[model samples]
Target: MSAAPQMNAQHINAITNAAVIIVKEHLGMQTGFSKPYVSGSQFMSSDISVVMGVNGTLEGQIICTMKNQTALSIVGSMMGGMKVETLDEMGWSAIQEFGNWVAGRAASELAKAEAAIDISPPVINEGRSTFRVEKTFLTIPLTSEAGEVLLHVSITPRVNE
Candidate 1:
């Protein structure tokens, strides 16, 4: 197996900032930034997680985790008052789309830092799955009227870099 990519200070700052900006703009809420930390895998165990793999200048995964109520409330508000008591298929889809949108925005913002990234489709994990980070990650807490959600972002400069 190959070693993980190294993330410079600039890359880290850009990625973290992009994540916070995208989430706050999309959800229209206040977000809190957390200091980046290293964990021996299992960075998070959440009720639901929307994960997407990224490639290009940066490589790693971006995960969005939240509780059932948080998901419902956010999706409900996004869809214009659509009731969301539980996470049905439609709810899952909504969350997936939101993750993709956020990642896309982050990628766009990364461009300003000369970092080109490509995000894959989001994979939904509903209360069952153990995702290993296998590298240092940054977690940012976003609070809204609904509840608190965490963004687990792990990206490193590509090997060629």
Candidate 2:
């Protein structure tokens, strides 16, 4: 088997830290980020996942996965106490926006290392799905009172000098 890619500790740390900060600031919820690790894009346990692309200094994708119920709870909170029970069009839109917000913030934080990165608009998907990637990915698992949010980050650094 081919060896997994080696990620810069600083880069991974920046992404993880940015996720924690954005979730708290944007959602008003405390979140915990697990140490990032390199792995294939395995199917997530969650029913809903928001996927976004990373381009520019790094090229890859970012996926924000969460359970359906958890997605509802988060959307509800974002709506300021409104109840959300289903993954309808509105729910999907909210999730995509949330994913965008997180990814944008993360890319900005990553750019602090002088690596210019930009995130693509989010695509929301429901149920279980499989992802295939040749390069190993940096996966960050985030936990909150609502539920778990898995951040599947895959990137290839560009040569900038």
Candidate 3:
């Protein structure tokens, strides 16, 4: 792993899989979640992008995003159903919970690799799906009987510092 700003594919996979495992193990889901996809987004609508700050030598935030359909399916399975037609308030609440789980898993995985990164609690966010070159991100497609979810992870250095 080339550290934060220049993360290698290994490190990225570690974090992405951790989140996927959390969703499956915790939510009792059984399916195949696709490998992580690292790409730029033309727009950021129709998805939830959450940023979590990490304070350290290479500081940045992990931005996790997912589409409405994915969120609804995951949330519905979490609530003992899979045919989620509409994403109601309860869906948002559940999505937040999922985000929380993902953040915790990512942070823990990083820590195990001797990367002292602290992730703040998940927060709802909206923005474009783009990042700098030295920047690194992970996009995972979660597959399940319920449906598939695209989880995006972006890493950038702290500019405020």
Candidate 4:
């Protein structure tokens, strides 16, 4: 872990918008951005996702997390049925793939802007009910037929100057 990634309002907005586009486009749902949740000792926890950060010039994370219901609905929608009750192996895989797509989309957006961006492979977690981030700079809320999950982008950018 190098120094935490630092980001500004513009970068935050850019990342948020790009990430949201990826989810909405895939799940046919809309992701909302509300007041960010702060982090401290034993802070709130949500989903654990692939945290990609570019340390050379800019630094940030492309975090993705979806609730079980959300994941199930998304998986169900993709498979053309709502009969699915839970996220099976196939449903889990669907969530991971969606995570990759969103991360990749965000990276593409940054790359198009000529920003150095590094992305990590998607990491799948079960509920992340106890996971905690030391930093809470940015957060995004996604809503689907399943449910809503929060994506908190905790980056300590290097370009604070």
Question: Who wins the TM-score comparison?
Answer: 2
Candidate 3 stretches greater than 4 Å from native: 1-4, 31-37, 40-46, 82-84, 125-136, 156-161
Colliding pairs, model 4: 4-156, 5-156, 5-157, 6-156, 6-157, 6-158
* lDDT scores of the candidates, listed in order: 0.76, 0.77, 0.63, 0.61
Ranking by lDDT: 2, 1, 3, 4
lDDT of 1 by residue, 32-53 (tens): 6554555445765578888889
Q: In model 2, which range of ten residues has the least summed lDDT?
A: 1-10
lDDT score, residue 72, model 4?
A: 71
Rank the models by TM-score, top first: 2, 1, 4, 3
- Candidate 4: where is the Cα deviation over 4 Å? 1-5, 40-42, 47-56, 132-136, 156-161
Candidate 1 Cα outliers beyond 4 Å, as residue runs: 1-4, 34-36
Which tens-of-lDDT digit does each residue in 1-161 have in candidate 4? Answer: 45644555665566666767865776666666656654432334454343444443566455666655666776786676556787778877777777777666766776666666666666676756554545554556655445765666654445555
Candidate that scores best on lDDT: 2
Error of 2 at 125 (Å): 1.5
lDDT tens per residue, model 2, 117-150: 8888888888887767666667778998778888
lDDT of 2: 0.77
Q: What is the lDDT of residue 53 in candidate 3?
A: 62
